[model samples]
Target: MAKERALRRAAREAEAAKQRARRARIVARRQRRRALLTRLMPRRRRTGRLLVRRSRGQRAGIAVVTLVLLALVWFLVDDIALRLVLTLLGLLCLPALVVVALGRRTS
Candidate 1:
């Protein structure tokens, strides 16, 4: 009975160690995937930089669209002073749009 107990304890210990090793491997794989993703994924550019990267097509499209939409909205409102208020609106929208584009999806 003593010998059997010892043998069973040793087997349990070995299985525990195997489980720990498997968990460690899984953690390592996840870390590697995160590292790879960060390297490959496009990150948001910090504000206040002289040069920033943007999708030219998207940038142009946004600008043109914003201008057209704002102009239409402005015309509908028909306030001359309001037109001056939106002088830098397009520039402001660029950074905001960039932030949204780079935002992560929340579960």
Candidate 2:
């Protein structure tokens, strides 16, 4: 009876050790996958950090669109003073539009 009990306990201990090793491997694999995903993914900037990157072509495109939109608004309005005000407002918004088009990034 004593020999039998010792044999059973040793088997149980070996099984438990195998289970522990399996769990450790699973955890390591998950951590590696997480690290790989993070490396591949693009990092996002915080809300307070609002720097945008604009290529030369993109900047020109934004400028052209802003001008065209401003011109259309000016042509639609009948009153000269109102047209001037709208144009000025559009001009003020030009930078903002470009910034939006450029897209925000941390790096």
Give the number of the best model, judged by lDDT: 2
**Residue by residue across 1-107, what tens digits does model 1's lDDT show?**
99999999999999999999999999999999999999999996567644335555766866787778777767776667766667466556766776687553332
TM-score of 2: 0.45
CA lDDT of every candidate:
0.75, 0.82
Residue 95 displacement in candidate 1 (angstroms)? 17
- C-alpha TM-score for every candidate: 0.43, 0.45
Candidate 1 — which residues are off by over 4 angstroms?
48-107
Clashes of 1: 0
lDDT tens digits by residue: candidate 2, 1-107: 99999999999999999999999999999999999999999997555633336556766787788879888987899999998898999888877765676656545
